[model samples]
Target: MAEPRPRVWVSQPLIDAVIEPLRAQVELITTDEVTAWTAEQLAARLADVDGAIITLNERVGAAQVAGATRLQVIANVGVGYNNLDVEALSAAGIVASNTPDVLTETTADLGFALLMAAARRITESERWLREGQWGQWSFQTMLGADIHGSTLGILGMGRIGQGIARRGAHGFGMRVLYHNRSRLPEAAEGEVGAQYADFDTLLAQSDHLVLVLPYTASSHHIIDAAALAKMKPTATLVNIARGGIVDELALADALATGRLAAAGLDVYEGEPAVRPELLALHNIVLTPHIGSASLATRKAMVQLAADNLLAALNVDGAAARMPSAINAEAAFAARTASGDKSKKR
Candidate 1:
């Protein structure tokens, strides 16, 4: 008799092209629904599966991992794996992976688009015109900030950040200043025509400041009232990064009182439910988190994640694993240390 094929579960619907290869190799269980699962539902479904392809909506934390004793790998469809309790999964000896480089340029494009929309009041002006407010064109009817010859500040200098800088420096003829944990090498800096700026300096000097940082414990709410107060009052703020980096309530208040000129947001702290105040304001540009929503890019992301899943599950003829596996051993160690700290406290 032949050996049983490894069982794979897809938590959400993915492009058929991306999953067809996997289906051929495994006993596939899939769902067309995009809804999130309850803890009990996730636990029950994972009980017998050997691996899973999950998206950002599902939380694959300690509880789910504990229930899925046979599970060995999880491939996240998105670049950000914050929804996964990585440390817990690592400790359970379960390999976890995400799609990264594939979506960098596409996400950067959305970031720059949002920056332009916010600066030029694109969405707001369009809404006003649609509401029958455009009787006639008047001088300074809908004046907005310029992109060329302006300083663009970036909060994070990751791959996506670098992509945005390239567009600003080469395409728009804008000065770029970036603040990150570490500065890029001189060669890279010269290539992108970007300069390193301290956080406060970047906040103060930039005509338009964009956040492209990740969400980590250290980076949570990096932009609060104090940080916002340091920014130029006339400057526009754009967040294409994770929503936790900014205090949305504070941002709404600032925009309402003209403490800041205008704002744009792609991600929210508690997503799928935006603050009512932000929706009411005309000085802000809001979008559902579609930073990497391009058809080509989304397809690439799904394929990349599928590849990672196949390799981790040791499927024959699958793509190679990502060079960086997030260092599972290190993650376990960090979690142990955190638990010890908590116990002592």
Candidate 2:
């Protein structure tokens, strides 16, 4: 008998172009609402699907995936898959893929934008102008830090971090310094004119600092009151990374006191629900996590995820390339093994 068409659950609606390719090989149950799906809803939606395409909004942990008996893969559109518990997914013999390279440059662009906005007081100045405060111009009115010929510090040195370093070093004539879990090789550092700095040095020396690290237990609150205290009083801080990396309460305190110059945050610890302390601060710029929000980049991310989903599900003649699976080996093992069909890997 012919194999039955795979049933897939799409967490959110995608543009027609991104979704069309999968229409022929998969039966899709897609949600039209942009709102995030609750745990119960996810359990119900994913119960019988062979695969799923999810976004950051969906939090899939052990409990969430407990009932996903038929689920073979979960493709995420964004580079970060913290939303989906990889350990749980791998244990379930389910392949989980994320779109990474496609959104690297786009996210880097936002990181730089946030850096400049925080350094130059762009958002604050705009609010001032809109409030009709532009009537008088003084020598020091709205004066802010300069990006050119300044030190640029990055907390994480991944692809996105490297892109930001290149822009700062080559385009702005800034000294780029990065601190990662492990230092990059000399050649890689030379490519971006970046130097490896210890965490404390990166905080103290940078005239403008940006956080681009992943969200992990170790990384959570890596930037706290003490870290903020190490920074120069006039330095600006920007976080394009996850919110939990920085203690939001400590950050707001720093910005409120004259200890730090200003801050720009694209992601918040609570997410979608920012701390009221941050909102009350005037020297900060807040964005609702639009790092990869560009029209073209978003489209590309969706397309890449769709392609990976197809490849992972092995739709007939779908190229069958392994998706950007975090646990590709385990997934392949699952495919090859005929015995021990337990949910956990």
Candidate 3:
């Protein structure tokens, strides 16, 4: 008799090119609709699968995984896994992994694009011209801040942050400043041509500030009205990080009252739903969290996630090759403890 193939659930349809490998080897369950899932909905689906490939939209926590007795692994399709309760997964002896390197450059490119677009009022001008409001050309009509020779401040100095720093320093003639929990070493600073700044200094000194920090308890609403008050009134703000990192209501007030200049945002708190106040502002540019949305990059992310799922499931051809597991130690420790108890029994 043949052994039963492991079942894998896909939260949503993935890139067509990356689905073939998964289809050939696993008993697959998948969804075509981009429907939002409540924790209950996700738990219901995960209860019977050995593993699952999911996106950030699915918030998988302790309660959500309570019914998932057979689940062993979760493969997140994006670099940020803030939506996942990793501690809960670790306690369940479930290994959770993410796709990181594949999206770094793509996300960084989008970050810089948003920075420049907001700084120079590109989208606003386009709207102005389209509205037949370009009848008169004045010297200062659409005058905007210059990217060249500006001071660029990055709030988080990870791989994507380093890429943005390189673009600002090497591609353009901008002075790059960065603030992380700890400063990068001198060697790394030189490679990116970036200087270290304290948080308050980063806020005050930068001509344009970008947020790229991961979402965490300490980082939620890190940028609030109080923080925004420290920024230059003429400076621009860009957030390609998670939405919870910035207080959206405070941001709206700042932009509406001219407390800050212009702004750009890719992610939002409770996303796919924008605050009506932000939508009313013409000085802000909003994107639907597509920092890693390039066709090639999206494909790479799905493939990497599939590889992680395969390895974590102990699937053939992917043996002993766990890639990008965030809580590998915890998962392994729990597994070992389970084995020890089983041997005694």
Candidate 4:
């Protein structure tokens, strides 16, 4: 009997180009319709699969990982891997990878676009015009804030944050202030023309504050009621990061009472369905999480993720095994030496 080819499952329908490269290498299973799958459904499909390519839609926590004992790798299609319990995957000896770097500039561009849209009430003004509400050219009919010469505050100073800061400083002549886990070196700061500020100072001084931090347990709802209270009443809030980073209810309250001037949200606490309160307000702008939605960028991201999947599954002769496996023996050794302290984090 011949050895069976590895079975691969793609959780969602991806661009044809992404899958075309994998077709000849494995027994591929994929869906044309993109929909959220239940845990049971995921478990059912995971059975007998050696590798899987998934998106942020499915929650691949401990249960799903444990059920797919034969599974060796999970190639996540997005930069954010919050949907996957990485610690659980690591413990299960499953290699998990994501598409990063490639989407950084594109996502940052969207973040800046959202900031400009929110500051100028772009969507609201368009709606008003479409409704034939522009009966007269009144001066104060749809007044909005100015972006240039304003203070742009950023929550996360990662690569994407630096990109936004560069755009603001160079393109818009905006003063940029950022709060990060650690300050960037002086040369890097000079390049972006950004100044490091404390969390409270960043919140209080910014004309437009944007969140681009990752989602972790410690970072959950980092922008809650107290954080909102710290910001300027006339400040605008823009979130292009993970949904759980901001408190939706508190944000709605802040926007409702004019505690904050306006908001531009690309990601919501519970996505696909935004809060009713936010929907009713005219001061906020909502998008369906399309930060990396440009045609070229989307294609590149999908291709990179497909490459990662193929590499992790060792499908192509040119592909390497999952990078995580290189350190797996070290992990096991450290676990034995440290009495299983390897999983503590």
Badly placed stretches (over 4 Å) of model 1 are 317-324, 327-345
State, as a TM-score between 0 and 1, how close model 2 is to the true structure: 0.95
- Judging by lDDT against the true structure, name the best candidate: 3
Runs in model 2 with CA error above 4 Å?
Answer: 317-319, 332-345
lDDT tens per residue, model 1, 1-345: 865778999998888878877777899999987867998888888888878888888887899877666776788889899988887887766778888888999999999998999999999899989999898779989888998889999999999999999999999999999999999999999988899999999999999999999899889999998889988888899999899999998899889988898899999999988999899999999999999999899898888777666676666635465533554455335446546311110
Q: Estimate the overall C-alpha local distance difference test score of candidate 4.
A: 0.83
For TM-score, the strongest prediction is 3
Indicate the worst ten consecutive residues by lDDT in candidate 2: 336-345
How well does candidate 3 score on lDDT at residue 313? 76
> How would you encode candidate 4's per-residue C-alpha lDDT over 1-345 as one tens digit per residue?
855667889888878876867778888898889878999888788766877888889888788866665676777888888788777777666667787777889999999998989889999899999989899669888788999999999999998999999999999999999999999999999999999999999999999999998888888999999999999998999999988999999999999999999999999888878889889999899999988888787778777766666675566446564432323444344446646532221
Q: For model 4, what is the error of residue 276's alpha carbon versus the real structure, in angstroms, after optimal superposition?
A: 0.6
Instruction: After the best TM-score superposition of candidate 3, give how far the Cα of residue 99 lies from its true spot, in angstroms.
Output: 0.7
TM-score: model 1 vs. ground truth: 0.93
Candidate 2 per-residue C-alpha lDDT over 59-93 given as tens digits, one digit per residue, 9 for 90 to 100: 99878878887888899989988888887877777
- Higher-lDDT candidate among 3 and 4? 3
Give the CA lDDT, 0 to 100, for residue 79 in model 4. Answer: 86
Ranking by TM-score: 3, 2, 1, 4
What C-alpha lDDT, on a 0 to 100 scale, does residue 111 get in candidate 2?
A: 91
